[model samples]
Target: MKAEFVCTDCRKQFIAEGIKNEYTDPVYGPCVIYTAECPLCGGEGREYSPNQGGDDHEHGMGPSCPSGGCCPGCGGM
Candidate 1:
């Protein structure tokens, strides 16, 4: 399946195909998840929900940098 993902290290966003893996989570119990790698950063990527803007911050990040990336508070841009 295809899903949106954000790199945990570099915070790059991209879409990639992944295979569903069935596993049991200690808190959520049995669950299915997709895993993929960031082609740009080669870092592990996590699925991102569309409902959550684009930034990963829970309360939202500060202003955007001149380059169109997150502010320095998030170590972005």
Candidate 2:
């Protein structure tokens, strides 16, 4: 089946399909898998399927602020 997941490194959205080997950590077993390049930074990585659709800074969530609000970590300038 096909699914939509966001890149943890880059907040860009993308679709993953044709995933044959969704298993990782043989002992732990296979889980959700991604088989596409990140749409934002073009990086290759994997994350839990549930982590999709979240704010990602490494992928450039925003330069300054999202909505005139302070950053979660740095607060504000």
Candidate 3:
């Protein structure tokens, strides 16, 4: 599967594709296994699209993170 992530630090958007491991059991656990490297800044905490395995999409720099953080506007920055 393929997924897209946006770096919160450098404000870089990229895509990640690789194997996915899903572990789910009744008494064991529901652990998801996956690894990805940032294509741009090589940084982590790249927020994934809500549908895949990350947070929701925030458009335009005019709005900040829900917690009130840096806002990378629609390429305005």
Q: Give lDDT per model, in order.
A: 0.70, 0.54, 0.55
Q: How does candidate 2 score on lDDT?
A: 0.54
The positional error of residue 48 in candidate 2, measured at the CA in angstroms, is: 7.2
Clash pairs of candidate 2? 10-59, 23-30
Residue-level lDDT of model 2, residues 1-77, one tens digit each, is 35565555765667764254555677787665555557678765343365344455334355535544455464432
Best candidate, lDDT: 1
User: What TM-score should be assigned to candidate 2?
Assistant: 0.37
lDDT of 1 by residue, 37-66 (tens): 999978887787654455544223433343
Clashes of each: 0, 2, 1
Indicate whether candidate 2 or candidate 3 has the larger lDDT. 3
Instruction: Estimate the TM-score of every prediction.
Output: 0.58, 0.37, 0.37
Q: Pick the candidate with the highest TM-score.
A: 1
List per-candidate RMSD values in Å. 7.7, 7.8, 8.9
